[model samples]
Target chain A: EADIYQTPRYLVIGTGKKITLECSQTMGHDKMYWYQQDPGMELHLIHYSYGVNSTEKGDLSSESTVSRIRTEHFPLTLESARPSHTSQYLCASSAMDRNTEAFFGQGTRLTVV
Target chain B: AQSVAQPEDQVNVAEGNPLTVKCTYSVSGNPYLFWYVQYPNRGLQFLLKYITGDNLVKGSYGFEAEFNKSQTSFHLKKPSALVSDSALYFCAVRAKAAGNKLTFGGGTRVLVKP
Candidate 1:
């Protein structure tokens, strides 16, 4: 039983191609986050949204953009994919409470050739 | 800046043995601590958290964590290690002033060999 879902669990695309990674949660959480991780490495925050139409850049610099049009959906898009964009993208959501922990979705592994 | 530290990159333990994964954190005020486990190619699963309560917090899969305020540590422990317990563990921390953002430590891979 997965509360959060990510589409195209694995993806391979050519350079300059635009790709959108979809993440949807059924938990009705208000806060969502995007993290990028390489193999056997730490996860880096890239983007986050507190609610619909409220998005902010995270600690890491990313060419990808995200949109939160609905409470349950937060999708990340790479405007122009490059070789460096190859990595795993993870999505997480948490409750409005400050003490609550965030729940993560099975990541999307992207490879830009 | 709120940060979490998992000093050991890998921890090896034999089955039926007590296991511990160490974690320490730094934050301005009282800290909200959490532990998550990640299996191969899977998203992280929350194991336990320490918002405020007893120092010993129990969580899923027979895991427990001890929150030490003076030492600023929350170490995950299991009474007996199992081969199935082999996975990557992450420590996270968040301060009240940091909004909802959680800063994560570099993961520690735990290998429980039979």
Candidate 2:
């Protein structure tokens, strides 16, 4: 089984609320990524981290910010959630080896009302 | 720009029948292609990938894919389908000229009827 885990399998909150999605991996991977997906839609990369203290925004624009304070943790935070932000958030991690496949978490489904 | 395209939005097949999900790609250099499956309310799981070597590559869950350089396509195939195989499949590509970032297709939903 994949070691990556995402907390709050489902969440529903009103607009303007602050929220955080947690992601952690025990695989000792250096690369971590966050992706957003609407139901039945393709996943869009939102944020990624190369290692502890290193983060980068992905191709898609997102209001959420992520922090990589430790190798095992990469959490995404939304300062103010909105209805448009409601979606499924997925977390993944992979070894630095080129061509290696990534392991993914079950995902967190967020609904901002 | 590097991109991956899964032309079909959905595919249906009866159990025990063969199945194929089409995918085509465009990249500046040699493509690193991958296939992933996502069950309802879950994240994507890696099914297979074609990095190099032979055009045919076998992967997890009795799945296989063929890489056709001439066609610039990588299509997922299964000899016999199972009802439990129903899920959402995604095709992704990363160009050698590009970085490690992967560009994913819209996705294809597979429905296997018993």
Identify the candidate with maximal DockQ.
1
Query: Each prediction's DockQ?
Result: 0.85, 0.73
Candidate 2: stretches off by over 4 Å:
none
Off by over 4 Å in 1: none
User: Candidate 1, residues B1-114: lDDT per residue as tens digits?
Assistant: 788899999999999999999999989898999999999989999999999979999999999999999999999999999999999999999887776588899999999999
Q: For residue B104, what is the lDDT in candidate 1?
A: 92
Best by lDDT: 1
Tens digits of lDDT, candidate 2, A15-57? 9999999999999999999999977688899998889999999
Write candidate 1's Cα lDDT for A53-108 as tens digits: 99999989999999999999999999899999999999999998879999999999
Residue B51 accuracy (lDDT) in model 2 = 93
